[model samples]
Target: MSEASLLKTQVVTLRVPNELKSRLEQQAKSQGVSLNNLANYLLTTQLSQLETLSGIEQRLRGRNLNDLKQKIAFLLNKVPHNPDLPEWDRL
Candidate 1:
């Protein structure tokens, strides 16, 4: 990336709850990032998720069980499954 690309970044100001501020500060320090950079990255990622979910929820709010089941199946497929081990017979 060139210097112009880095210089094209926008400045944003946001107020976080006091507890979250301390946690973010610690995370930023440990990751060797400035607080602003950490906040910007997190906010950008979460905001994108929020926008997507908001659209989905708006469409599905009053839908029926079939829709709900399909959503559940989609999420379940994304998760790794672990099978239960057989129980040992006690003496």
Candidate 2:
């Protein structure tokens, strides 16, 4: 494991509705990760995505479709086109 993954974590309590909690538990089981892992991943990734979209919205507030397409293509190009997935990441 990486040092970052080894860092200490604190427990947090949330009072989610029963339905939401059940859904999250089901999703975590389907994804082969503990509920804690799934919750942590969802919270961290969703926040980052929300922040990214906020910045993109401000930048492209008055932009046209072509501008949006170009920005999307530029961002997509940054990802490597690798098909191989490590065993831990395979689902």
**Model 1: per-residue Cα lDDT over 43-88, one tens digit each:** 8899999999999989988899798899999997887654554455
* C-alpha lDDT score of every prediction, in listed order: 0.86, 0.92
Can you give the lDDT of residue 64 in candidate 1? 100
- How many clashes in candidate 1? 0
Expressed as tens digits, the lDDT of each residue in 29-63 for candidate 2 is: 99999999999999999999999999998997887
Each prediction's TM-score versus the true structure:
0.52, 0.56
TM-score attained by model 2: 0.56
RMSD of 1: 7.4
Worst 10-residue lDDT window for candidate 2 reads 82-91
TM-score of 1: 0.52
